[model samples]
Target: KKLSRFGVRSKDYYLYLFFKRAHKSFTLLFGCLLPLFFNAICSVITFGLLFLEKQFRLLDILFQIIIGQ
Candidate 1:
């Protein structure tokens, strides 16, 4: 019924269907990756705050060494 309604299903149609199924299956995995990306960004901000004043000599030295600053 669906095939007739949509016309004859071809290889291209099956490929699209498979991709849609795979995307739905990995929804949870995508959700987890989003938090991981934000956590990395937040860590950068927190580090910036702690060292923003150039008060931590050790951290300043490390940053300069790492960043060639």
Candidate 2:
């Protein structure tokens, strides 16, 4: 009876269907990859800063503000 009141789905109807079908696989993949991606970024930044000089220039400051650094 209530189904007849709203005779339309939504734009995200397919998304809801996908979640119903493949929720486990998607969550498992994300769980496995998230930590690896974060660690890779952290290691890269640490490695560069470890070997680089510690001097800061006016240009560096300016570029940092401009580029949201």
- lDDT (0 to 1) per candidate: 0.84, 0.74
User: Per-residue lDDT for 8-63 in model 1, tens only?
Assistant: 56666888899989998799788889899999999999999778756777777988
User: Number of the top candidate by TM-score?
Assistant: 1
Q: Candidate 2: global Cα-lDDT?
A: 0.74
Instruction: Give the Cα error of residue 24 in candidate 1, in Å.
Output: 1.7
Tell me, by lDDT, which candidate is best.
1
Q: For model 1, what is the C-alpha lDDT against the true structure? A: 0.84
Per-candidate TM-scores read 0.48, 0.45
